[model samples]
Target: MFDAGLSVEEPVRGVVLLRIDRPQALNALTTASAHGMIELYTRLALRTDMRALILTGAGESAFSTGADLKERAGMDAMAARAQHMAHRLAFSIRRGFDFPVIAALNGIAHAGGAELALSSDLVLAVPHAGFALPEIRRGIMPGMGGTQALTAALGPRRAMELLLTGDALDAETALACGLVNRIVAPEALVSEALALAERIAEAPPLAVSAVTRAVRGAGQGGAEAGLALELALHQRLMASDDRLEGARAFAEKRRPVWKGE
Candidate 1:
């Protein structure tokens, strides 16, 4: 559905795998690819069967090097502005996905690519993978949630240092900075990501969605507001059929078959 720039696969039931396929360009995102991603996420949002999504690059060299500079160089100011808007829309769709989204960073994720990884709920990167926001070096600044997301993930000071210096963070440093959940070997990256997705997909869908929403709310608001949101979501989930099924299954000593209610 994403043309040649992206590809989709159902590696397991209820789990969707999305790969950025422009390895020859270090999996860089052109305008077409960005719009394709937005369209794909929009369609996926309406699918009842989608439980989790894993995003990665097609090759080991890069998750993505960010925007296709060659394409950007040829664009006028108006065209650049339009492309920026498209990228923002795509990232927003990624961050708003109801189910869990995992970023499997197999290689270098620079500039917009790093921003994309930040949008994911969880990140699993390979040992050889590295991340950076080198837009500063190119006489530009990150425009795709880079600064804000970095500040939220790392503290303001740390984020500032990286953004100002345009230095690359290795996998270990990224993990320490809380940008990634875990680091796996290159060969194990996909397997580990899929295993994590499968585990999440096995949970009750309604409860999973509630947790995702509540946690995201907490990140965006104060403690008091977050607590209120959590309570409201908990109350709402209590009335769902999946909650009843879960309780019944526990009492019967069997697995609950969730209907995503």
Candidate 2:
């Protein structure tokens, strides 16, 4: 079990949990935390048994306040650059995770914290958890891939308005705007996320990977290319060992055992 400055727990099989540990700092992302997150994600990406990941903060107060500006305060130009790179690495880690990455937003996620939540495949928020991009208030903009992901999720008009004004939106508003996939009680956040992950995990791993790849490919090309990729992936998954197990289980009237092939 790697500490990585933060804490990680796997309460459900095949679903990893990553929690931001700096609750005293409202779970802010320091350089160490950022690097640790990247490392965790990178490592998890290679695990065949890991089917999904869930990211959350330690407490109900905040998911993350984003970057730890206080930690970087008084840093020289070189150090600042290094910090920025570390932040980028954290974002890349989330992006590169092959299986589903779910964000369990237990509380407020502002600036970088909000970016992190938005980076996930699905965001399940507490009923009162708020989202915001207040970088403009700091005379800056979102440094992580927040801008791009927010734009992709919420579209240009809303993204520009939020980024330009640094306004915060409540959980209800976030759900209404399609920023979060679902909302639940603060106490139920983890359970809800885990339930969703387990449901996905129970399916054939190859089919899940194919679905993820096909959806990712759809944004890069016209329908023709997307269809071709989808068909190719479908063929590959159908011939996988897991598919045979699925067929055998169906014939036997039992649950399939996934080999993750």
- For candidate 1, list the clashing residue pairs, or say none: none
Q: What is the C-alpha lDDT of each candidate?
A: 0.90, 0.85
Please estimate how well model 2 matches the true structure, expressed as its whole-model Cα lDDT: 0.85
lDDT, model 2, position 233: 93
Per-model TM-score on C-alpha atoms: 0.96, 0.92
Q: How many residue pairs clash in each candidate?
A: 0, 1
- State in Å the error of residue 126, model 1: 0.6
> Residue 86 lDDT in model 1?
89
What tens digits encode model 1's per-residue C-alpha lDDT throughout 95-212? 7878989999989999999988987889999988898999999999999889988988888998999999999999999999889999999999999999999999999988889898
Candidate 2: which stretches are off by over 4 Å?
1-5, 222-225
Those runs of model 1 whose alpha carbons end farther than 4 Å from true positions after fitting are none
Evaluate residue 254 in candidate 1 and report its C-alpha lDDT on the 0 to 100 scale. Answer: 97
